[model samples]
Target: MTEIRFLHIADLHLDSPFKGISSIPQSKWKEIRESTFHAFTNIIEYAVENKPDFVLIVGDIYDGENRSLRAQALFQKGMEALQAKGIPVFICYGNHDHLSGKWVRFLLPDNVQVFGEKVETKTLNIKGEKVHISGFSYKERHVLEGMHSHYPVANGQHIHIGMLHGSVEGNMEHDVYAPFRKNDLIAKGYNYWALGHIHKRQTLHNDPPIVYPGNTQSRHRNEQGLKGFYDVTLTENNATLQFVPSSAFIYDEVEVSCEGIVHANELINLMEQSLNSYREANGNAIVELTLTDISEETSELIQASSKEEWLSLIQESLEMDHTFIIVKELHVNLPNMERKESNMLLEMMEEWETAEWKHVLKDLYRHPKGSRYLPAIDEQFMDETMQEAKEILSKVVTRGE
Candidate 1:
C-alpha cells in the first residue's frame, strides 16, 4: 500500500498590496500590511508543523506585472523551511507568474521544480511508490486553449496527479485561461487534480478528488469566505482531502437593521451592540457593517449629523475595551416604504411637484442639440430632482411624526 500525504495550496498572490491600504493613515497602513504578512507566517508555521511529503503550489505565487522581490524572498524562505525537513516543492506558473523571457533567467532553488511551457509529467519515487506529477507553465496572460487536453493519462502503477492554474468551463467572471471541462479531467484518468486561479475552494469530482484549494489569503471583498489550503492523503488509488484555515485576519460583512431605531443615538447604540456581537463571534476579525433598511427619519438623522462623527463614535466605542480590534464603517441609507404611505395628501403633492419640475426641465433640455449638453446638464438636474423627491416623498410617506 502506497501511503503519501501532501499540502496543496495555490493563488498565494504573494507581495500583493491590499487595496486602499496605502490611502489609510501611515500607521494604520503599516498595521494592515503587517497583518497580511502575519497571515502568511501562519501558513508557513502550519507547513512546518505538519511537514507533509511535499508541497504543491498551483499558481499566482506573486501578483502579476509588478511582482515584488520581497515577496519572492519571503516565499523562498518559507519553502526553505519545508526543504529543511527533506520535503520537495512543485510549482506551476499561472497568469500572474506568466513565463516571460526576462523572468526565465532567475534561478530557482534546487528543491523547487517548476513545470515547463508544455504539459509534461515527472515521476517522484517515494517509499516504493511512483507519484506522477504533470503541469504546464502559462506562456502568456490569457490562454484560450485547454491546457488539460495535452495532459497525459496515468502511466505505470503510480498515483497520477495533475496540477494546473486556469478556469474549467469558464467560471463566473474568471479569466478564460486554459479553459477545460469537468469531463476533460475525468477523461485524462488522473488520480488527483490540483487546480488554481479561482479564489474559492471547490471540489469538482469526488471520485478522483479534483479540487481548487483557493487563495491562501483573500485579496478583496468579492473573494470572501473561509480562505485556506488543502491537505491530501493518498493511499494506493484513494485520496482524502482536508481544508486547513490559514488566514490571520478574517473579513466579514455584518448586516445591522434599523427596524425599531427611530433616534440616531438608538441606532448608534444598536450598531455598537451589533459590532460587539460580531467581534465575539469572529474573534478579532475585521468587519464591514452594512446598515440596511434605514428609514427616511434615519436618513435625515445621518444627513444632519457628520458621517465622520458617527464613524468615530463606533470606532471609539469598539476600541474602548478591546485594544487590538479594527472596525471599518460603511453607512447606507435605504428608503423606508412604510414611512412613505402615511400621508396621502403629501404623497399627491409630491407627485404633482415632481411632475411640474420634470415637464419644465424636459422642455428646457429637449432641443435637437440636447444630446450634446445632456450628459453634463442632466446630471445636475437629476441630482436636484432626486433631492426634492426624497424630501417630499419622506414627508408624505412617513408613518411616524
Candidate 2:
C-alpha cells in the first residue's frame, strides 16, 4: 500500500482576454492583464517547492484553439520549471484549445506528456508505485461524440486516474462536448476522475473521488471567489483532497443593504463597510456591486444623479484604500415597483423574452471578422444582460423624466 501525491489543475485559459472586466480604464492595468499568467506561475512555484509525484493539467490550457504565442511561451516556461524539479506532467487539450487549432506550437519539456486525439492510457512508475492515467485531447472545437465511452477501465494495478474535459450530458447551460454522466464514470471503477470545462470547483463522488479543479484564475464575475487547483493524496484505501488558492485576483459580487440609507455619504459609508467585510476576497478584486432593498426616494435620487456618477464616486473612494477593489459594475435593485405604469415594464420584459433574443444575437455575430472577438454567449450571460437591460429601462420609466 503506497501513498502518492499530485496536483490537479484545469482550465488555466492562459492569455485569456478578460472581456467585460475592463469596459473603462482600470487601476493596476498591467497586473489585471497578466493575472492569468501570474496564477499559473504560482501553481508551478508551489509544485517546484512541494515536489509532487506528478501534476495533471486536464484541459483548456489556452483561451482559444488558436492559442496566442505568448500563451505557448509561458506554458513552455512553466513546464520547464517542473522538469527542473523532476516532476512529470500529464495534459489533455479541451474544446477551447483543440488539436485542430493553428499555432506555432512552442516545444515543451520532456517531462510533459500530452494525450493525443484518441483515448489512450499512460502508465508511470513513481516512488515504487504504479500509476495509470487515461485521457484524450479534443481534435475539433466541438467534440459531440460520447468520447467518455472509449476510456478503458482500471488496469487493477496500483492507482488508476481518468482525466476528462467535457460537460455532463443534459447540461443545457454549457455546450455538450465529450458528454457523459456520473454513472458512466463510476461504472468504469477508476480510482479518481479529474475533470475540467466547468469553471467552479466541485466534487461529484467522494468514494472514488470524481472532481473538477475548476480554472486556475477568475476571469470575470461569473467565476467568483478563490480559483486554483486540488492537492490530492491517494492511498490504496482512500483519497484526501485539499483546495489551494493561487489566483492573482478574484472576480466577486458584493451586495450591500440600502434599507435605511438615504444620502450618498451614508451610501458611501455603507458600501465601504460592506467592501471591508469581504475578508475572503483577495487583495485584488473586480467587484460587481449590488445595492439591494432601496426606497423610492433613494431610487429617484439615484436616477436624478446618473448611475455612472455614483459608480465613479465609489470607484474613487475605493482607490483611497490600499486594497485594489474596483467596482466594475453597480446594480441598484429597486425595493418594489410602486411607481406608475410599472406594468408596462413587465409587459415589455415578457415581450422581450418571447422574442428571439438568441436569434438576434446570432445575427450580431454573423460577421466572421467581428465574431472572433466576442465572448461566449451562454445562458448565464443572457440572464445577466437581460437583468441589466430591465434595470436600465425600469430607471427610465420610474424616474418619469
The candidate that wins on lDDT is 2
Superposed by TM-score, candidate 1 places the C-alpha of residue 105 at a distance from the truth, in angstroms, of 6.4
lDDT by residue (tens digit), candidate 1, 1-401: 48899988888877667874432234455655655466677777887888888889898877774566677667778878777777888998889878862442346667789898899887787787888899998887777788888999875456889998988785677777899899999888878899999888899998888899989776556666568899999886578898998776666678888766678779878987887777676655556677777667677776677776776677776667653445565656454534544355445544555456567567665787755576543446656756776676676555222
> Clash pairs of candidate 1?
339-397, 339-398, 340-397, 341-397
Alpha carbon lDDT at 194, candidate 1: 93
Stretches of candidate 2 off by over 4 Å are 22-24, 279-282, 296-301, 337-401
The Cα local distance difference test for each model comes to 0.75, 0.85
In each prediction, how many residue pairs overlap at the backbone (N, C-alpha, C within less than 3 A)? 4, 0
**How well does model 2 score by local distance difference test?**
0.85
